[model samples]
Target: MDTEQQRFMNMKRRVYKIVLPVLTVSLGLSLFMSAHKGLLLTINLILLVGMLFAWLFLSTKLPLRVIEWFLLTLAGIYLLTMVVQGVYTQMLGHGETSLGDFIVWMPMISLLMFLLFDRWPALIANLALFTVLVLPAVPAFPRLNPEQNESLILFYSGIVVYTSLAYFLHQLYRTRAEQNAMLRFAYVDALTGIANRHRIDTWLRKKVELGEETGKLFSLIFFDLDNFKDINDIYGHKTGDDVLRQLSKVVGEELDHGDLFGRWGGEEFVVLTDTGEEESFRLAERLRKALEDHDFGIAGRVTASFGLSVNRPGDTAESVVSRADERMYHAKQAGRNRVTGRTMVSGDG
Candidate 1:
């Protein structure tokens, strides 16, 4: 699954984790408060049993979508029961006809709707609930006192206002999520799923600017698979792609925290680090050795030519990259599978 979908499912799981326990505890209390043998007690027991079942399945590997639908169905049934109870009580002349019991619960139900669905679905569900509440009030309006009329108006207005605000907030959240997804797509390489060249360039420029301001040094290691073209030529590009992916995974594991690794284009990669010349050289040698030791299955033994460059005073991103590129070619010329830097060279020349 993609990161966003995973995040959404995780969020739903967390919501269920909290909501289920709270509902169970509340129902347990209601059962305690109700008469031990009546319909109210019986209904609470049934709900508590359902809640327990939901909690059990939640702890298991039940899909969150199914759980969500189950909860929403329960909510629908509960609302329907409330409406029926209100109508029956009014008909028996034992309760007020103002829908006070049902209306009082609307705000909480509206919040649940917003939490459980996206913008339009939530809005539509809430509007349907509002209509249900409003329809019953319409026929009784002329019989209501002025105070009751005002209360009803205020309640309806509040729901409308709250729904508008919720819709606005959901829209804002969706826009932010879309922007984040777009940014991730732009900066990450599609094939290897590492930072792409654009991200590397942006990172290098920022590092250079930071170094210029703070007088702190940093380094770059530019490397590419030796004879990568030959691999593509002989084994075909599919196997070559697999080799590159495996190579990235291997190199990525060797990097220290705070180091930035990116694909600099086909078969070429770069590493940016806060370490100075000596440490950077050591890191490059480690990467080279790691590559040498790894077997690339059908690609057989494979190695990389590395170029190391430390930041110099007044160095721009282009200049630093150019130096690393030059040294990398020098390493290739000296013989592949070696690291070449300004004052140091490793491997058989």
Candidate 2:
């Protein structure tokens, strides 16, 4: 996974870890506080137990998406039970049929719906809940006293307010999600699932700026597959794509943390690192050896020509990448599987 997606998953796990325990405790307290017996008490007990199970499930190794759906399902069942209780109490005439009292949990339900779901789903759920809450009042509206009419007006007004706020929040969330997806699409290569050229260029410019400010140098390693077209011609484009994907995985395994590897273009890849000239050359050599040793299945053995270039004083992003590209070309001309920037060191130096 990419950094942003990994961070998002971690954040979700933390939020759920805290929320599940709080909800379990709250349900336990509610059961204690209520004077109800029989079915209502039994239902609350069931809900409390469900919350405990949910908490345990969250602690398990299940995927986050599964956990999210499970929690939302639990919430739906809980809300449905509450709706039944409210309607049954009104039918039995056990208490005054105050819409306000009956819907005391509506705001919380609305907030949870928006929090747990995306825009369209949350909106639909909220609207359905609102309809269920208001439907009972519809038949009795004409018989209500003036004070009751005012209360009904206030309830409707609250619906409008709640919906407006929920829509605003949903729009904000949707906008942010779309922006993140767009950024991922722009930066990530579709086929190999690595950084694309745009991302590489952006990282190069940022490194250039950082190097100029702190006098900390960095290097760029550019490489491309040798005899790649022959593989496409002999096998098919399908095998060629498999070769590129496998090559990316191979090179990725050799990279250090914080190293940026990207698809520079077709059959070409780049690596940006915080290493100097000698270290970058060593990394390039290691990568070249890795590609040489790995079997490409149907395409057989595949190799690449590598070039290394360290950041220079007053260097532009283009200048750094161009020098690396030039050296990569030199490596291709010299042989097909050699590093061309620096002297070859012995024994994986």
Candidate 3:
């Protein structure tokens, strides 16, 4: 997993750790404070113990994913109990009291939904709770006194409004988080944690466009692992992937600030920097040497070939990349590990 995803999971685990104990204590205090020693009290005691046990188990070797599922199930059961209590109270002609209690707890339930799950599951759970709460009020409307019915109307209205707003806010948060995740996946190479081909293309296009407008200088280095297929064939694909990831890191560390580096395809990579042709070629040679010196463990020593190109006036992304790629193949043809490139001039083919 990526760092961001790991951090998110850790935060969730911490929240669950706090929530379980707090909920158990709250229920325990409520059980003591209540006057009735009937079925409701028994249920509350049972739920309190369950929550306490869940909290204790959280710190054990039990998997956090299992605990998360348990909490969600527990929350559902708690909601069902509230609904049942509301129905029982209404049947006993305590509609006002029941509705008030539901109103007070409705926000808590909504908050729990937001905390426990992502947008869609939370929305579905809240919708089901809202439906249950409102259904009872409908048929029992005429039987209620005018004042009681009016209060019910107001309370139900508040419930709907509160849940609607909650849902909206949660949905907004979910949408943004999803967009961020999509962008990360789009731009990042999963194996190496570097920019992928699409990101490299996008960065180059922007740099090329900016250079065309303002006379800013930029260059690209297209390179590939030397004899990469042989390494994969000898050591298996797993170690070959490791060599790529390690080499990417080592070379990436050597690049200047604001430069972009990424995988271009299998065994091929690219780097972009705002440097002249000479500096770009020097940077490419530095990268080639760095990989040559590094030990790739199971893959043994590795080397790379590089080609450099300087951006010229009116140069498109395709033209600049094609030139560098052509030089790269030339480097491969001349020798296995080397740097070969030339700068282009305005109006030069």
User: Which is the leading candidate under lDDT?
Assistant: 1
| Candidate rank order under lDDT | 1, 2, 3
- TM per model? 0.83, 0.77, 0.65
- Residue 298, model 1, lDDT: 95
lDDT of 1 by residue, 32-135 (tens): 77444544345456656876787778888888777766766766666555544444444224435343433444555666677778889999988987787677
The stretch of ten residues in a row with the least summed lDDT in candidate 2 is 91-100
Clash pairs, model 2 backbone: none
Q: What's each prediction's clash count?
A: 0, 0, 0
Which window of ten consecutive residues has the lowest lDDT sum in model 3?
340-349
Q: Each prediction's Cα lDDT score?
A: 0.81, 0.78, 0.76
The true-versus-predicted C-alpha distance at residue 161 of model 2, in Å, is 3.6
Candidate 2 segments exceeding 4 Å error: 1-18, 38-43, 50-104, 111-118, 139-160, 209-215, 342-349
